[model samples]
Target: MTANRFTFRRLDLQDMAQASRIHRAAFDNSLPWLKGLHTPQEDQWFYENCVFEQCEVWAAFSPDMAGIIAFKTGWIEQLYILPDFQGHGIGSALLRQAQTTFPHLQLWTFQRNIQAQQFYEKHGFIAIGKTDGSGNEEKEPDMLYEWRRAGS
Candidate 1:
């Protein structure tokens, strides 16, 4: 779909439920290191507090459906699209917008998640370091990636 066909909006408290559902579904099993990151209660808490206070979440919506494209600050907190909405350029648009605020961005992905590593590399982010889980020992070895805006 073309950029013109999608509308982007800042996520509000009311949008949290949908966003949490999408987030949990998209990242849960896919990013094993973050496996239990969003239990129902945590999801609700994040939507009610953390999301609006510490991060910026943008939703991309078409006439029929909506999904979260990106969330970030100095770091990319999350980037997820509904299964049906994947590969429609919403992810790229969201990243582009986020780069405006965080000219240099960084994020972590499980070492075993090759797809996410590839996606980050394709988007100009370079593997910078590694850490042992983000507290999820079940999924150890997290790879850290960083992207510096062209000149910086």
Candidate 2:
């Protein structure tokens, strides 16, 4: 799909539910620690107390679809696109726009998620380090990625 086919808008309080759902869905399998857990209350809390203020959430919506493609960009936060919307350049568009405000950007992805790593690399983000966010080395390893503006 072309960029013009969707409209990008700033996330508002009214979009909290949808945004939370999108976030949970996008990170579902990538973060095994959260597997089988439904934390809508926690999600709402984070969206209200942390996410809404610290990050800028943008959603790309198509009139033909019932849901929106959402992404949140902040200090060390991420750009998450729904599974159904992946590989369509929507994530790239969101990342590009986020970079306009915060030129130096970074994000963490699960080490096992090769597709996500490749996607970040394809968009010029370089792996800088790794961490075991799950606290158990055998479970989940998170890879840190950073992107510096051209010539920087």
lDDT of candidate 2 over 42-130, digit per residue (tens): 87777766777777777777752222333344344646667777767777777777777666877877888898899889988899998
Q: Provide the overall lDDT of each model, using Cα atoms, as 2-decimal numbers.
A: 0.75, 0.70
- Candidate 2 lDDT: 0.70
> Which candidate number maximizes lDDT?
1
lDDT of 1 by residue, 1-152 (tens): 76567888888778777888777877764765567754787787776687767778788888633567445656887787776676777777777878877778888777888877887898999998987765754557888899989887
TM-score of each: 0.83, 0.82
Consecutive 10-residue window with the lowest summed lDDT within model 1? 64-73
RMSD of each: 2.6, 3.3
Off by over 4 Å in 1: 29-38, 69-72, 134-139
Best by TM-score: 1
